[model samples]
Target: MNFLADLLDLILPEHCAGCGLAPVLLCDACALPLQGPARPARTAPEGLPPPWTVTTYEGPLRAILAAYKEHGRTALAAPLGEALATAVKAALTPHHLPTTREAHRGHDPPSLVWVPSRRLATRRRGHDALRGLVDVAAQRLRTTGVPVICVDALRQRGRVADQAALTARERTTNLAGALDVTSPTQIAGRPVVLVDDVVTTGASLAEAARSLRKAGADLLGTATIAATPRHHPA
Candidate 1:
């Protein structure tokens, strides 16, 4: 499966989804159509702020991410993780400092916590996608001299339905209170960032953030690979 997947990626990439491309998932010309996100930072849903999507999901970015997550493209983690690190650094420019343990909305420390998938999902997929990216992102952060901490301290409290077939409201309700910190002592009073694949309604991140808060960790905003566009016209 892995060998075949790799071969198909090389020889059979479709045209850019956002723009018809010259026989590639996305040509260089169209791969970076999007600049950084407009409101690149946020603390909460009501306070949802600028989000940095380093690349638009139109061309190669979409294909790369989809292949990595859905198609088991583990080999692409290095480049994709580097891109994600760039996106994260771009958001942390002003206060990429090692000043204090307390993390404000804008000034975040280096620690990253992932919103864990349900046990069923992880078992079925046989990979922890967020963890893989975080590992590489942590390395990239270190190269830039940013301290990074990966705390897999959070775990799924229960299993839920496949989120893809659900409505936004369902996604929200399904993930509520579904996470908790396993090691409360270690993360106590440490600044932390929540990492995940994507943010649609912000429910999973919120629940994880709430757990971290309960365990005495400072919460920076969460980040993801992709997000559903807000307010698409009918």
Candidate 2:
């Protein structure tokens, strides 16, 4: 199934993933919104740096993400991943003594860890969506000379109901204690940024953060491609 999906990605996809306008995977105009000066997320809980996002999870961005995640439009990973790369860079800039990657060379570069999806979800989709995006995001950063490490450090412990219909409080409860670090050695004492595809109520990021901190990660902040509209305000 995965092989067939990859084959289809190359042969199919005649329209832009974001706007469906034509001949390219993503048109520049549609990619504009993903380019952001990442801002503090409105839903950030106390004690964690706000997860910075590039755009609101709506319109073209939403469509593109859905296509890539749920529908197997794997080709869309390039643009979305690059957008995630931008968000990651922005999220770390302010905290560094100097803004450029060159300046941070002396110290160990931060690790980018993503929220792990459930095994059931991965099986249903035949793909681990967010992990693919994070891999690309890290690659995009590396091509531009950023020193970084991408780690698949978190793992889900047990089943939880689908988050699609959950309210903010319910989401928090459902995900509480649902994730754990697979290897503390990979994250311990290192500055880390949590990555995700979207931020709805921030329940996932908060839970991920909790596990990473417990494992001894510095927990620089969180970064995502987009966030719910209410969290992305004007």
Candidate 3:
């Protein structure tokens, strides 16, 4: 099945989602920036769980994410999700991962909980972009022997203004009290990681962590494919 998909991708001549110059979904040039080692997100908000990102969100990385998330370039999910899987591994080191005995006791693999997209945004994009990426990331991790479960456990509790034009502080203020967990039992007492496509001010990640903690989640960390320069200035 995987071979067939790869063959199809080659046969279809799909342009690169990042640069649109290479004859592939993600060309080598664009993928290079996403190959960085995952590192602790230095801009994590004071109260949020430790977060990790694989690459700086700029240039091709930013373009790829925007295309996947906002422009309906669904194929970009594979590469972006794989990048997310890398960040997840870095966030959950030996000390952070759940013990085998603990996993057996709970009868649940570690959870990958994604920040939910706004209903309107999902509708406009014709899909839940971040959720799709989380699902793919979980699959990729499992293939490499990382037992994990992707859970659609977070939901938007209210509307929020677009964050693009907002400052870091405004983004934090706009997201306050805006998220809620769908099920406490799913996360309660489980080692979990929050997932998102990108982190800017960390406002969304912070809110998601708050809701997870309220649900009794043993939230280990957060993971994303990229982080904006606002958080990692040159």
Candidate 4:
């Protein structure tokens, strides 16, 4: 670890995000609570595509994920990325899901695409937060021969309110016309997995899915590191 990272870790002190065990951000015992193999998560608006989460975004998991996104805890990205890979593997297992799951997984492994960060946020944050998890996830998926390819499929066209603080309808409006596909050919021939960090309203992924489909891509599903299980509009 770099001095800065070491300093950060020192100041914050690394503890298991779940159970507070030292020497690792996520200890085996804490990770053990995640049941079963990875599988596709049931998202609303049926017929769109299958979506997946490595584990429920609740309790200790929620704290860990929120730290990475909203609280500037970038070091946790690797673990979250691994969790996402686990979710993708579950999504791939036909037995774990309903019979229709085969229809999505049998052919080609979907190319993974992160919901392109808004230019403003990229500048403000100085790093593509979601990209870290996406890249590591692709690396993890490689172990199973699932091809996770990153393509600059979506581009943010303009400014939008923070999805975290917005109403669901506002989020939809904020993301309207926000993305454009520059290379449809790559995604057109295979399924594309829309990726992001948090899935509060899911407006971001939903819109990205819409844009990808409009560009003629067959989307397998979406995946994220953290998904707010319930929608309580603030």
Report the number of the highest-lDDT candidate. Answer: 2
List of clashing residue pairs for candidate 3: none
**C-alpha TM-scores of all predictions:** 0.75, 0.87, 0.88, 0.76
Query: Residues 48-78, candidate 2, lDDT per residue (tens digit)?
Result: 6788888888888887887788778788888
Worst 10 residues of 2 by lDDT: 96-105
lDDT for each candidate structure: 0.65, 0.84, 0.84, 0.69
User: What TM-score would you give candidate 4 relative to the actual structure?
Assistant: 0.76
lDDT of 1 by residue, 36-77 (tens): 442353323653334444543443566666666666657657
**Tens-digit lDDT string for candidate 3 (82-123):** 889999988877544545555667656789999888899888
Give candidate 4's whole-model lDDT: 0.69
**TM-score for candidate 2, residues paired by index:** 0.87
Model 4 weakest 10-residue run by lDDT: 94-103
Ranking by lDDT: 2, 3, 4, 1
**Candidate with best TM-score:** 3
Q: Which residue segments of model 3 deviate by more than 4 Å? A: 1-13, 96-107, 231-234
Provide the clashing-pair count of each candidate structure.
Answer: 5, 0, 0, 3
Please say which candidate is ahead in lDDT: 2 or 3: 2
Candidate number that wins on TM-score, 1 or 4: 4
